[model samples]
Target: MLIGEVSQRCGVSTRMLRHYDALGLVKPTGRTSNGYREYSADDIRRLFHVECLRTLGLSLNEAKRALDEPDFAPSELVGELIGHTRARIAAEAELLRKLERVDAAAPAQWADVMGIVTLLRALESESGARRQQAVLSQNEGASLPVEALAAAALSEHDPNVAGALRWSLARAAGEGLTDLAIGLDSAVVEVRRRATVAIAAVPTAEATVLLRRALDDGDVMVRSRAALALGSRHVADAIPVLLGMVVEGRSDVEAAEVLGVLAEVAAAADVIVLAMQDKLDNTDDAPTRLRITQALAEIPGVAARGVLAELADDGDRTIAATASAIAHTLDRRKRQGFRN
Candidate 1:
């Protein structure tokens, strides 16, 4: 087939095909007497494989390695690529969360009109320079151009523009953008809120300090957001505060959510283990006990395994099932590690 036929069939532009040829990615099977490129069936098949790899986000160089090395398993490479993509997504998600809070805090008038315009303007400016910086904070590693574009989009005030920016930000977060969580200004309430949500999505040591400060805010809303954000960091130091809220505070639902977040961040088995122990021993609230057990499962560490084993024998079938599942996962991980 000629270049045009291949481009039309494969959905790749002729320019891209030419570039691929230049890079020795997919050479023509032969050349016409007139010096035009001619692709054989094998060349077309190779082009398809290249296209697939590109779709998977592999750089040409990376894809070339996979193609050239017959023993190279695309599955393994794809798994690694997926991990990278997830990190980027997480970071971008964090950015979207921050933007959402910005939108929420903006005056209602802005929501109706000029607000989106302002956001778009801000995003456009950032998109030019700070995009990479923002995305780099996430684990996914954002490039300068992409980050700049995203920041520019985010700074716009037009609701449509802001919405698009938000979408891009969310995608960047899903790709594991973590940069926005760093060096946040706690003095600004909106900034704090955005930081809180972003930190919750991707908890870090620095975020713990910010969250702790927010938890101490005089405003209940600030305190709630802070407490909720602490879920991602899973800092044991915050446990006493979280426990107090759950036991004495009016917002039981919020407290429960905090517990759930803590469970995700918990490294020490006893923190959640002891919380579950307390809830089980003193609280006749079957529902609450079940909730605590579920949270306990979120902690992933060796200590959790022991606690889970103990809980598996609990009288409550629901708790027992959760504990059994956790124990099974831990055991499987251990076995896999041993084999490795």
Candidate 2:
């Protein structure tokens, strides 16, 4: 086949075939009387091999070596190609994500598009300060897309940056709740915890519902954060987890405080006091019992008074002293109220 015929049949352009010949990569096996290049069947086979290697991301030189070198080992080269291909694919995928985020912002002009792009890049910057600044200064630019904020909040490891991201997401009025809700089911424990952290700041009823669902997460941190958030929102669903936190000494003080707030309700007070009493009954460690005794001080109802009175003369002197002190204070308050 002549050069043109070879180019047409092999899909390699004539210019490229000439370049290959100049590089000594593939030379036509013969020449016609007019001295035009002519390719034999063997030459066409070599050209096909070069094209095949190119598809695998081999440079021309590497492809030539692969075809001509009897000792050329493809194993290492193939592995390198695979790694390069994966890196290229990852880069392309990231670009696509960036484009999607920009498109989602629905920029009205080039300036708005530029601002959003700049903000997006800053959020992904290596510096935690930059990431935080981007979120905190979001109002200076076109409003950030809520989905971007949600993604940043979920993936951020820096406490300050993550907090800022969550705050920003909250200000978006729960627009990113869908993304955050999906994060709740992530296989990654940190992701779920971060989602809960972000959702906790959102005051919308939808956010409250998501937090309630997060309370049942298998990860203790997720459940703890969700429970605490729920407790602050006056959701009774947090009671069981709050009680567990008190029992396990995990953020027990904050848990106790929230429980106290929950205890303001008459019915909730009874249940809270009864649960603490049950814990006291089953627990033998003096420190655990002491912690529970102190927690009971936060509750003001009559049921809590009964538990405090019984604990006042317990075997542990420290527990007895603390309980007696609390009971005495409650009595003084009760009497003071009566006097008025």
Candidate 3:
């Protein structure tokens, strides 16, 4: 077959076939008297082989060596090609993510688009300061996708950066609530803690409801935070978790204070007092009993007073002493109030 016929028959362009010949990658087997390049069957087969190698991302030199050298091992070259392909795929995926984030921002101008891109890049910076600054400026550009803030907050390590990220998410509120809610279920303890903190600050009814659900999370840290937030919001659902915190000695003092607040705000002081008394009856540990006795001072009203009076007679010396002191304090406050 001549060059043109070969081009049609093999589907390799005449120009490309000539270029391959020049590079000694593929040479026609013979030339006709008319000075046209003539390809034999063997030459046609080589051209087909070169095209096949090119399809596998082989460079012309590599493809030529593969066909010309009988001992050429494809294993090493194939491994290299796989590595290159993986790198390209990763690069392409990163680009796609950037585009999606930019589109989510809905930038009004080229400058806004660039700014959002810069902020997004800085959020991933190795410097904690840069990451915090990026989050603080998260609201400056076009609205970023809530997923961006959620992703940043979940992975942030530096205390300052994590606080800033949580604050930013809370301020953004409805924008990222769903994504932050999902982070509440993260396998990483720190991420779940951050999610709870961020969601706690969100001032929405939906956010409150989300935090209430977190009260049942397996992580004590998650449940404690959610319980505290709900307690402050007068959500009586936090009662069980708060009592558990007192019993487990995790943030027991703060839990007591929040429980007091919940009791006062919701007028559930009797209920709170009853729960404390139940724990007092079941618990045999001296220190846990001490914590519970101290926690009682935080609760208000006559019901808490009666519990304190009964605790004052307990067999434990420290428990009896603390309860006596708290009972006197509450009695003194009551007298002072009546005098005023």
Candidate 4:
């Protein structure tokens, strides 16, 4: 077979076959008359081998060594190729994601495209200020990338940046909520807590469901934050976790305030008062008992007032004084017709 025949049959161009010959990777087996290059069966086989190695991301030099070196060990080279292929795949995937995010922004001009790219980079920047600016610059009607915002919100460590990212994620109209949900199940405890915090303000039913579910989260902080948000939403289902916060003294002040709001509902009042009483009965921790006493101040009606009156004579002097003070305040508020 001649060079043209080998090129045609082996799917390699004639120009490339000549370069292969020049590199001594796959030389022609013989020369035909009038200076036409000729290839024997072994030369065609070597060309096939070169093409095969190239498919595995081998350079031409590496391909020659693979074919010609008698003691060439394929294991190390193959492992390196695998690593390179994986790196290329990851780079391509990231590029695809960047392109998708940019497309979603729907930039109106080259300047807008550049601006969006800049903001995207800032979101991943090492500086928290830049990340925060990226989030804060999002316009009301602009098509900012919600997925990036959600991801940034979950992973953000800086309090200021996390707040801005959460704000932006909510402004995305819940589009990124699904991605944020992944953070709720993250192996990192802080990530799970952040996910709940970000979702807490979304005001969507899906966020509500997630917040409610997080009421049962293994992390106490997750449950407390989720309960606090759920409480603000007037969700009576959070009463139990809110009570648990009172028992645990974790964010008990805020938890008690939310419980007070929920206590406006008659059913919530009963559940909240009963759980507080139950915890008080089982625990001898003074601080927890005091927290429970203060939490009672938020609850209204006869049942809570009765609990306060009984606590006024409690064994602990601080508890007794705190309970007595709350009762007097309630009486004064009642006299002034003040109610939550």
Candidate 5:
């Protein structure tokens, strides 16, 4: 068959076929006398396998390596593919979380408040001290000293200044500033970075509110960070947000991280089971679904039984076998509990 026929049959593009050929990732079996690429039945089969691996989240390089190796075991290759899928899912999850954060801080009032807090903190710290010292040194030998000193001190304590500071702190806390602070120094960077740190410093109750707000933010990066912070705290309130990211968020990595954190929290078996069920139904993206299934199995209850059963019946032999292994482990635990 020619490239066009193979592409039509396999649903892969001719460009992709050509690129694959160039990369030695996929090649035709032979060539015609006129120099057109010729593919055999085995080539079609190889293409199908390559497509399956790609859908499973294997990089072209990884798929080629696995396929090219004569001794490659399907089980081993599946395992490697599973790991890669999990990583990609995690990255997507993170992107969703950042988007939520940006949405929450979209209001001008909110941004102004956060900006004020950053400005005040910058002033009260070493940066402020250096500025003050520089001003005093510059004023040395000037005649109008007493009035200027009083004016400067009063300005520092002005009601407007105080109000701005409070507002900024409130905004920062709302933006998950505490966690943001972990990565910063007194030397200020962008306004967003300052707001991130300041938001992280807010009281837990207030911070939770801010994080929740940001989870719905229009900006992906903001929502992503907010989800990430919420996940870190293992807050039950974040479960829905995390689930939305897993199901719909743009950034697979962030979503995966959120899911991983949620799994660690694993408070409700029903939630994990539902997530597993959803993943199974929505995507044949094997690697990500596998991670979700494994996470579901980790939850401590009988709710996961149905999901595990479904997974045990999966067409992918490796997934089915892994699911069976997990089911057996869970069954042992259940038996032990009954005996006790």
Candidate 6:
């Protein structure tokens, strides 16, 4: 077979085949009378081998060594190729994600595209302050894409930066809701918690619905944040988790406050009082009983006062004293027409 025949049949271009011959990687072993390069059957086989190695990401020099060096172990070279291929793939994937985020921004000009890119780079900065500034600096002039903000919010480990990202999402008018919803489904517990935290700041009904889904998250913080957010929206579904947070003493103060707001309704106040009473009955821990005692004070109405009145005379001295103090305050408020 001549060089052209080999190039045509084996799919290696003529110029590339000549380069391979110059490099001594797959030299054709025959020549016609006109002195044109000719390829023997064996040379074609060697050319095929080089092409095969190239497909696996081997450089020309590496392919030459692979075919010519009897002592060249392929295991190490193959492993290196695998690593290089993976790195290339990862780089491409990251680039694709960046492009997608930029496209989502729908930049009106090259300047807007540059601005978005700059903000994205800042968000990924090693310095927490820089990352936070990236989020804080987002304004009407060069508003960031909501998807970018949502991604940053989900992955940020620093509380301050994360808070800024959440605030940015809140101002995005629910644009980040869909990304945050997908984040809620992430297998990473912190991602779910961050998603819930960010979603809580978004005041849309869609945000409220996503928070309800997070209420069942396995992470205690995720569920607690969701419950607290829902409680602020007066979603009744948060009642159980709110009570649980009080019992566990996790963000118990905020939980109690939200519960108090929920208890403004007479029917809800009645149920909350009973639930606190149940916890007080079941727990022998003085701290837990005290937390329940304090939580009950947040709720107004006769039902809470009735529970407090009963707790005021309980056996635990601290709990009884605290309950007495809170009950007295409730009475004073009622007398002042602050409660019924």
Total clashes in model 3, counting residue pairs 3 or more apart in sequence or in different chains? 0
Clash counts for all predictions: 51, 0, 0, 0, 52, 0
Model 4, 1-340: lDDT tens digits are 9888787788899999999989999999799788889999988888888899999899999999988899999999999999988999999999899899889767788877787788788887898887888779866777677777787788888999999988887887788889899988899999999999999969899999989888888999998899999998889989888898788878889999999899888888888888888888898999999999999999987889989999999999999999999999988988888555
How much is the lDDT of residue 141 in candidate 2?
39
Which lDDT value does model 4 have at 145?
Answer: 74
Name the candidate that leads on TM-score. Answer: 3
Model-by-model lDDT, in order? 0.61, 0.90, 0.87, 0.88, 0.60, 0.88
- Best lDDT among the predictions, by candidate number: 2
lDDT of 6: 0.88
Worst 10 residues of 2 by lDDT: 138-147
Q: Decide which is better by lDDT, 3 or 4.
A: 4
Expressed as tens digits, the lDDT of each residue in 140-237 for candidate 1 is 33222234333334233444444443444555433323344432444655544554444444334554665676676655555666666665456655
Which consecutive 10 residues in model 1 have the weakest lDDT in total?
135-144
Worst 10 residues of 3 by lDDT: 138-147
Clashes of 4: 0
Model 2's C-alpha root-mean-square deviation from the true structure amounts to 3.6
Model 3: per-residue Cα lDDT over 239-324, one tens digit each:
99999999889999999999999879536787888898999999799999999999999998888888889989999989999999
**Stretches > 4 Å off in candidate 4:** 103-116, 281-285, 333-340
Q: Which prediction has more favorable lDDT, 4 or 5?
A: 4
Regions of model 5 farther than 4 Å from truth: 1-203, 232-234, 244-268, 328-340
Per-prediction TM-score: 0.37, 0.81, 0.89, 0.88, 0.37, 0.81
Candidate 5 residue-wise lDDT, 1-340, digit = tens = 9999998988999999999899987789899999999999998888888898888777898789778988867787788777877888897985564344334334245544454233323444544454344333322222212222222222343334433333434433333344343323223233333343335445576566666666665555555656667766676566665655555534655655555566665464356557657767888777766666655554555567777788899998877988899899888988998999
lDDT of 2 by residue, 239-311 (tens): 9999999888999999999999989888888888888888999989888899899999888777888888899
User: What is candidate 4's CA lDDT for residue 141?
Assistant: 75
Q: Candidate 2: which stretches are off by over 4 Å?
A: 29-35, 145-148, 186-188, 280-290, 300-340
Predictions: Cα RMSD each: 23.3, 3.6, 2.6, 2.9, 30.9, 3.7
Of 1 and 2, the candidate ranking higher by TM-score: 2
